[model samples]
Target: MIYKFCPAVLLLILSFSPGNLFFSETKNVKEIAKVIKTSSETNEEAIYNSLNSNQFALPQLESFKEALKGFYILKEKGLISKNILTLIDFSMSSNSKRLWVIDLTTNTILYNSLVAHGRNTGNEFATSFSNSPQSFKSSLGFYATGEIYSGKHGNSLKLDGLEKGINSNARERAVVIHGAEYVSNSFIQNNKRLGRSLGCPALPLELTDKIIQTIKDKSCLFIYFPSDSYKGASKLIS
Candidate 1:
């Protein structure tokens, strides 16, 4: 009886041992850290650092953060189906390659090309945006890539604006992505700025097919501008 009692006591002591407690606490700590790392803002900063270190021409970190934030939210909501993210930095001058097509899954830059804003937006920089039909001014915010259609622009990709009152009228405005002779380097050298689109985010005629194919079909497209009003009011990114 005394031997059997000793074995039970030993088992109870081991169950309450510091080593057991240490293992349980360590596991809990790891789980907590995993949750924090998964949702922390530092994750965005880390991704930006990774992209920047890769030598790809990336958008400003602030803009990239906002773009990434919105991208995640949109993806969670099932608005964006693809892992590709297209960012058009309207804050940058038209002469620069402000359009960045990124592969989020692979963490690589697919295309860094010149994308033209609406003619009424600005000459060198896009300062104005509108969602009104025929406004011909580019609308700022998030957009979902729509079906590819052979319209007047030829093999154009339609864009479904996601932000209401900011760019929801994109389809009605016919603000699609298409090839444009004016969106090339030659046009920029002659005009001192890239040619403007009616309201479309026009791409170089040469890259139009490739970009349209890659970004089409429910990818995330974010037209970023450092506007206080848009930032404050945007329901998606705000």
Candidate 2:
């Protein structure tokens, strides 16, 4: 009787042992698959490029790429209705001070003119300031400072997180596209240096109005820089 009972007890203990317990292997497999799918969806080329590049080096190139990515994404998302006209590749020179208008739809270089930018002396970061004056002398960079006219000018295109401040307010800064005499090829030939603006992108006075009109309203205008921070922030270029 004792022997029979001992054998029965041993069999019962083995059945409940940790080694004999069956884990849900299928559940673990499903979880891993879900993680992979999520990673693939969010991993775009923009993210990879930004991560690999040096942040402080080659700011202009990075900025241009980002601007491109931004426009491309906007088109993809149906935010922009028209085709890109051009990608002006300027910003190569510390004293370059020019804007290149490219025909995005045709890949043609429409115009390359001398332009003026912010004084490299005051601030390396050409910031948009409120309380700044409006005249050419007062214009820090052709932008109006303050909250008085936050959403009143032009159509409010969403810059998303790219630019600071509101669209309406941006107009008050008077950052409209314009031209300048100093930005002409003649000026470059004579002076051997591109002109500088307070902060507004002043183009050749000859082409300023036309370029403004062409890119006014709903068109996209990208100002490129080579900062690593900009590259990481934009989605247009990889």
Clashing pairs in 1: none
Per-residue CA lDDT of model 1 for 155-198, tens digit only, reads 99999999989999998899999999999989988988899989
* Weakest lDDT window of 10 consecutive positions for candidate 1: 1-10
Q: Pick the candidate with the highest TM-score.
A: 1
Return the lDDT, model 2, position 138: 14
lDDT of 2 by residue, 1-238 (tens): 1222233344544445354344744554465456544443343233324432222222244444455556656565655545443233344552443355544565444565555555541222333322233433212111111111123322222221224321223344555445566666676677666665644556666665555545543445566544454345434443
Per-model TM-score versus the true fold: 0.83, 0.50
lDDT of each: 0.86, 0.43
